[model samples]
Target: MPQSIHFISIGGSAMHNLALALHQQGYTVTGSDETIYEPSRTRLEKQNLLPAQTGWFPEKIHTGLDAVIAGMHARKDNPELIKALELGLPIYSYPEFIYQLSRQKQRVVIAGSHGKTTIVAMILHVLKHYNREFDFWVGDPIEEFDTTVRLSSTAPLIIIEGDEYASSPIDSRPKFLAFQPHIALISGIAWDHINLYPTWDEYVDQFESLAEAMPKAGILIFDESDDMLDVIGQKERDDITKIPYLAHPSEIVKGETFLITKQGKRVSTKLFGQHNMKNIAGAITVCDRIGITEDMFYEAIPTFTGVSKRLEKIAESTDRTVFRDFAHSPAKVEATTEAVKQQYPDKKLLAVVELQSIDNTNKSFLDKYKETTDAADQVAIFIHPGSADSGEQITTSDIQKAFQKPSLHVFTDSAALQNYLLQERDASHIFLFMSSETFGGLDLSNLAPKLI
Candidate 1:
C-alpha cells in the first residue's frame, strides 16, 4: 500500500505544490485548509487532492497515516494538528520534510534576501540544458518546468530556493536552516522579515548561522559586491570552500543584454540588468561545483527567458513594454527598477509598487523605500490595507514623505490605481508593476491590452 501523508493547510503555495509532488510520487496524500486560492485550488482540484471541504477536519488525521506535513497557515492548536499530536504521527514542516526526502542526495540551497528565485531558475535552466537529473523547489513559476517544486527517487541532487521567512507556524527557524545544504550560495544579505528578525543585526545573524551550519567540506558561495554578503563571505570558515563572485561582464547591444566571456566572446541571454548578471554568476558558480563547465552554462542560460513575475514582460510593442516583478523589498525594488530603466534608456518609465506586507508598510522599515524607485521617471505606491492586518496605519502623506520623491503618487483604492495605470499607458511609457501581491487584485498580465 502507498504510504499515506496528510497535510494541514495544504492549500498554501508551497504546501499545495509539495502535496502535488508527493501525490505524483505515488503517495496517498490528503489535506485540509480553511481557504485556498486560485492556481493552487485549480491544481489541487485537478489532482483530486483538494479536501471535500475548506475547513479543518480532525478525522482526516488517522493513525494509519505515514506522516503529517503542516504549513504556517495552520495554528498549533488547529483541530487536525491537535489530532495529529494525539495520534503521534510523524509531523513535519515542509522544509524539514524536504530535507528528509533529500537526505541521500546532494542538496544545493540558493538563499538570499533577494534573487533567490532568479538564481534558482538560472541553475535549473543550466542543469536542464545539459539534461542533468535533479529535483527542485523554487518560488516563481518557470516556463520550462510544469510545477514550482519537484522530487524524485532517481535524481541525485535537489536545488531549492531558500527564503529567510519562518518555516512553519510551529517552526520559527528560517526555511533555509532546515536544508543543511551540501552546497550553499548567499546571493545577497539585506534586512527582510522584520517581524521575525525584528532588528537588522538579528536578521543578518540568520545568514551568519547558515554559513556556520555548513558541514565540514561543504561548499559556500556568495556575491562579493554586496557589502553584507562580503562581510559574511569573509567570516572564518576554513572548513568549507568559500567562493565569491562579482557580476559577469556584459553589454547591451541594440537593447539586448549579452554576457561577456573571459575570452571576449559575447554570450547572448534573454535576461538583463546588473543584478541578473550577478545572479547568473552565482548560478554558474553553483553549476561549476556540480560539474557543469562555463561553456555549458553560457549555452543553456540564453534559453532561460526569465521567471514569471521577476521582470516578466506582460505586454510589449514596438514602442513600449509593460513588466511585472515580484519585488517588494527595498533592494529588489531598486534593482528591478534600475534594470528596466537601463534596458530601455530612452523610454519614459513608470514604476508602480504595492505594499502588501504589514511589516513592509510599517514606519520602522519605511526608510528603506527612500529613493528605491528613483530609477523610474515616475513612481507610484499602492497600499492594500486589506492584505496587511497591520493595525499600524500610515497615511498617503507618510508614504510620500518616506519615498521623498516629489512626483511620487500614492493610492489606497485599487480602482484608482488601475485607472492610473490605464491612463498612464502610452507608447512613450514603459510600465513596471512591482509587488508581492496582485496590487490588491490588479492583473498586471491581463492589463496587456497591447500598449502599442
Candidate 2:
C-alpha cells in the first residue's frame, strides 16, 4: 500500500503547497481546515486534495495512516490533532516533515529577516536555467512557480527559504531550525516578529542559532552590506566556509535596470533597485558554490522577474504603473520605497504603506519607523476602516508620530484611501503599495487601470 499522510488545518499558504507536493510524490494525502482562503482553496481543489467538507473530522484520523502533518492554523485542541494524539499515530509539523523528506539531499537554506524569499526564488530560477535538479520550500509564492514547496526523490539538493518564525503552535522551534541546512545563506538581519520575539537580542539569537547549527564543512553565505550580517558572516567558524557578497553593480538606463557583469557586459534585466542588486549578488554567490559560474548567473538572472508580493507589478499602462510588495517590516519598507523612487526618479512617487504584522502594527515598535519611508515624494499609511485602534493596532496619530514626516498622509478608512488613489489615477505619478495585508481589502487591479 502507498504511504498515507493526513494534514491538520491544511489550507494555509505553506500547508496547501506541502499537501500538493506530497500528492505529487504519490502519497495518499488528506487534509481538513475550518477556513480555506482564496488561491489555496482553488489550488487545493484542482489537486483533488481539498477535504470533502470544510471543517475537521476526527474520524478522518485512522490507525492505518503513515503520519500526520499539522500546520500553524491547527490549534492544540483541534479535533483531528486530538484524534491523532489519541491513536498514538506519528505526528510532525510542516517543517519537521520537510526535514524528514530532504535529510538525504544537500539542503541549501536561505535564512534572514528579509530578502530570503527573493534569494531562494532567484536560486531556484538560476538552477532551473542550468537545468539543475533541486527542490525548494519558499514562504511566499514566487512568480512562475506553481507551488511554494517542491520535493523530489531524485533531486540532490533542496533549497529552502528558512524564516525564523515559529514552525507551528505546538512546535516553538523556528521553522529554519528544523531544516538544519548543510549550506545556508543569510540575506539580511533585522528586528522583526515583535510579538513572538520581544527584543532585538532575541531576534538576533535566532539567526545566530542558525549559524551555529551548521556542520564543520557547511558553507555559510551572507550579505556583507548589512551591519548585523557582517558580524554573522565573520563569526569564528574556522572549518565552515563563509562567503560574503555585496550588491552586484547595476545601472538603470531609459527606465531599464541592467546588471554590469564582471566582464563589463551590461545585461538588461526586469529587476530594479539597489537592494535587488544585493539580492542578485547573494543569489549568484549561492549558485557559484553549487557549481554555477558568474557567466551562468548573468545568463539566468536576466529572465528572473521576481517573486509574488515583492515589487510585483499589479497594473500598468502607457502612463501609470502600480506595484505591490509584502513589506511590513521597517527595513523592508525603507528599501522598497527607495527602490521604487530610484526606478522613477523624475516621476511623482506615491508610497502607501500598511501595518499588518505584530511588529509593524504594535504601538511599542512605532519608534522604529522614524523616517523609514522618507524616500517617496509622497508617503501614506492605510489603517483598516473597521479595525479598533486599541491593543496592537495603531491609530492615525500613532503613524503621524512614528514617521514624523511633515507631508505624510494617513488614511484611517478604506473609502478615503480608495478615493485618494482613484483621484490620482490620471496623475503622472508612480504608486507603490507596501503592506502585508491588502489595502482595506480593496481590489488593486480595479483601481490600477484608472491611475496613471
Candidate 3:
C-alpha cells in the first residue's frame, strides 16, 4: 500500500513542489491551503492532488495518514496542526522530511546567503549533461527538471540547495542544519532575512553552525573570494577535506562570455556574469570530488542556459531585450544589474525593482542598497500598492536618497509604474525587471506590447 501524506500548506512554491514529488513517488498525497495561486494550483489539479475545498479541516487529519508535512505558511496554532498532534501522527517540516528521505544517500548541500540556487542549478545541469542519475531539491525550477524537488531510492546522491532560513514557524533552526551533508559548499555570506535574524552576527553564526554540522571526514568546499567564507574554510578541521575555489578565468569577446581553462582551451557558455562563473567554479569542484573530468564539465556546462528568472530573457528584439530576475537582496541586485551592464556595455540598461518584502523598506536595510543599482543607466523603484496601508512608509524621496541616484524614479501605483516603463522604453535599451514578486500584480505578458 502506498503511504498517505497530508500537507498543511501546499500552496507555497517549495511545499507544492515537494507534494508533487511525493505523489510522483507513488504516495497518496492530500493537502489544504487557505489560498492556492496559479501554476501551483494548475499543477496540483493536474495531478489530482488539490483539495476539493480551500482552508483546513481537522476532520481530514485522521490516524490513517502516515505523515504530515508542515509548511512555514501555517500558524503555530493551526487547528490541523493541533489535530495532527492529538492524533499522534508524525509531523515533519519540509526540510526535516527531506533529510529523512535522503539520509542514506551522500548529501551534497550548497549553502550561502546568495547564489545557492544558481549553484545548485549548475550542478544539476552538469550531472544531467553526463546522464548521471541523481536526486535534487532546489529552490527554483530548473530547465529540464519537471519539479524543483525529487527523490528516488535508486539514486545514490542528493544535491540540495541549502537555504539558511528557518525550517518552519515552530522550528527556529536553519534548514541546512538538518541536512548533515557528506559534502558541503558555502558560496558566501551576507546578512539577509532580517525579520528572522535581526543582527548580522546572528545570521553569520547560522553558517558557522551549518559548517559545524558536517560529519567527520566530510568534504567542505567554499568560495575563497569572500572574507568570512575564507576564514570559515581555513579553520582547521583535521577530519575533513577543504577545497577553495575562485571565479573561473573568463573574458568577453564580441559580447559573448567564455571560460578560459587552465589548458588554454576556451569554452563558451550561454550564461554570463562573474557571479555565474564563480557558481560554475564551485560546481566544478564538487564534480571533481565526485570523479567528473574537466572535459565532461566543459562539454556539458556550455549547454546550461541557467534556471528561470536568474537573468532570464523575457522579450528581445534586434536592439532591445527585457529580462526578469529574482534578485531582491542588496548583493544579488548589484550582481545582476552589473552583469547586464557588463554584457551590453554599448546598450542602455534600465533596472526596475519592486520592494515587496517589509525588510526592503526597513531604514537600516535601505542603507545596504546605497550604491547597488548605480551600474544601471537609469533605475526605478516600485512599492506594492496594497502594502501602502501597511505603515512601512517608504517614500519616493526615501528611495532616491537611499540609492543616492538623484534621477531615480519611484512609484506606488502599479499602473503608474507600468506606464513609466513604457514611456522610458526605447529601441536601444535593455529592460531588467528584478523582484521576488510579480511587481505587485503587473502582468509582464502585456508589458511593452510594441517592443515584444
Query: How do the candidates rank by lDDT, highest first?
Result: 1, 3, 2
Model 3 C-alpha lDDT per residue in residues 1-452, reported as the tens digit of each score:
22899999999999999999998899999999999998999999999988899999999899899999889999989999999999989888899999999988989999998788888888888888778889999988887888999899889999999888888867878898878899999998888688878898898899888777778999999999999889888898879898999998898998899999999899999788888889889989998877788889999988888878898988887778889999988888999999999999998888998877877777668878889999998888988654532465677777787889765888888889888888887633889989998877889878845444
Candidate 1: TM-score?
Answer: 0.96
lDDT of 2 by residue, 1-452 (tens): 23899999889989999999999989999999998999989898998888889998989999989999999888898988999999999899899999999889999999888888888888899888878888889888877687888898889999988888888768888899999899889888889787788888998989888888888899999989889878977988859999999999999897899998878999978888887898888888888888899888887887888888889888887767899998878888989999988888888888889876556767778879898888887887887654432544567888899898887888877778889877766554788989888877878877777675
lDDT of 3 at 86: 92
Candidate 2 clashing pairs?
320-452, 425-451
Weakest ten-residue segment in model 2 by summed lDDT: 385-394
Model 1 lDDT per residue over 1-452, tens place: 23799999999989999999999999999999999998899999999998888898898888889999989899978999999888888888999999989999999999998888889988898888788899999976788899999999989999999988888777889899999899999999878678777798999999998999999999999999989878888888768899999999999998899899999999999889999999999999999999999998988877889888888887777777888888898888999999998998988999889887866787778888899989899888999754343565677877898898987999988889878777877624788888888787876556766444
Error of 3 at 333 (Å): 1.0
TM-score result, candidate 2: 0.95
In model 1, what is the error at residue 313, expressed in angstroms?
1.0
Order the candidate numbers by TM-score, best to worst. 1, 3, 2
Q: Which candidate number has the best lDDT?
A: 1
lDDT of 1: 0.88
List ranges where model 1 is wrong by over 4 Å: 385-390
